[model samples]
Target: MPTILTFGDSNTHGTQPMRSRSSDLPRHARRWPVILGEELGWDVVEEGLPGRTFAFPDAEMGPHMDGRIGLFIALESHGPIDALTLMLGTNDLKAQFGASPGEIAQAAGFHLDVALSDEMQDRHGGFEPFLILPPKPFAAGCLAEIYEGAAEKAQAVQDAIRAQADARDVAVFDANSVVSVSDIDGVHLDTSSHETLGRAVAEFIVAEIVEA
Candidate 1:
């Protein structure tokens, strides 16, 4: 069976304001890997930390620290990761460098490459990795301030992620493109939104991992 690892924040964790069935947000499963595993028949592992990002911020539970922390955990863990999906930037935008979304995404991808390289090896002990990009933040009311305009910010980040993916020769899925946000917070995925994300991700994994 293929083993996929997902690391991100609340979105990957399926966190909502209230408890609801996984079906509500089929994609954002407070335990999304579990739902995806059931749907795709793949062994999914989640290492999502709330309020974390791929880059560390300057505050406690800040983006900068949490970002690197997730990478370290993924690297140190024992498992041959067939695929890795990352959903970050929400907290990074909320905490620091709101307008530098492109730069933040570039830095995040760089660190992810480092962690994957350290963890995986080719026949000659080289790095092999798979990566996915989270969709742009849902900009509604308060979300706009948080994301500094999620549409533009998300586009910048997406461009950066694509560049890195092309350079690394890894598969890329644009989650931001697949799902639409419906919350005032702009960061959290609602039930319907989460389900949409899960379905899109599951389809990507099924096509990339199973069919391949």
Candidate 2:
């Protein structure tokens, strides 16, 4: 069976909506990756951490600094990965962490390309990357201080990814095109939004992966 891996934070983790407790189990059924896997009949691995990022001010944010270290470790432990879906950047835009959305997006994009390239060479022997650019947060006044120019930042990063995909002859899905920012929390994806994302990703893979 083909395998797909999702790498990201809380939203990607599918945290129980409006939960107050820390030990709440994720609603995996509501997460896009799980839905996509079901729709496509693929093995899905959910590696979405709650407080993870590509960059952080703290030295000990997680096992990976750029998010790729842990990714490498995960791949080594799990064997081979056929596809990778990354949905991050929300936490990296927090002002408390002193990371701007532009910087976060750019740096993350770069590292993502690097990781995909390495994974392709090492695992698949060479596979085009499949990327997903998540939409801007839906909440107002939440990231205003940190991601002051987030919309623009997102666009810039999306454009760069598109260009990179073009160069690498890969595929990409812009979540902003499918899920509206007005529909959910500035950061979280509601059930409806998750459904949309799942459908979109499933469609993309069905259309692109065979030849890719």
Candidate 3:
């Protein structure tokens, strides 16, 4: 079966909104990654870390937040992947991080470069890369203070990511186009949103992978 390796933050990790950080939604069936796998009848390896960022580290959240390092490790362990899907950058908008969207995109580009390098391709026997623009953040209630300017940052990052995808000639999917942030926490997806994202992304992967 074709195998896909998915990398990103909490959304990719299938965190349940309004729940504690230690909690997670049932990833085997509910998360978009598994849903996509079911739709395509393919294998998916989920590698999502809450608070993950391509540019910065959350000292409070631990070193695992650095997605670049995590990607390196994942590529080493999950070599011979058929495809990769990435959805990151929201955590970079944290107030303490102080990263501009352009910088975030640049950091993400670094990870993409590493993932698509000739060395990685040789290890994976070749694979396609897909960039998924995370949903725009909703800065209200619990997220208002820490996630200030999150909507704007998401927009900026989305534009930058699209440009990068075009330049690299990789597939790009706008998560915002198919799903919206949950009103409960303002950052995570609701069950319905997850369903929507899964269906849309499954269709995208089908066209890109099977049809191509």
**Candidates' C-alpha lDDT:** 0.63, 0.64, 0.83
Model 3 C-alpha lDDT per residue in residues 59-99, reported as the tens digit of each score: 88888788988998999998579999999988888888888
- Candidate 3 segments whose C-alpha is farther than 4 A from its true place: 19-29
* lDDT (10s digit) by residue, model 2, range 1-212: 88877777766777544322244555657788888888989898888876666666335455454565656665566636677777666666554556544566566566456656665458755534466777665334433454454554555555655565556555677888888543323556677878888888899888886664
| Residue 69 displacement in candidate 1 (angstroms) | 2.9
What is the C-alpha lDDT profile of model 1 across 56-110, one tens digit per residue?
A: 5646454444677667667558466566676666666653455475677677677
TM-score between model 1 and native: 0.77
Error of 3 at 100 (Å): 1.0
Q: What is the C-alpha RMSD of each candidate to the true structure, in Å?
A: 4.8, 3.6, 1.9
Off by over 4 Å in 2: 16-28, 57-66, 97-102, 118-120, 124-128, 138-152, 181-184
**Between 1 and 3, whose TM-score is larger?**
3
**Higher lDDT: candidate 1 or 3?**
3
By TM-score, who's the top model here?
3
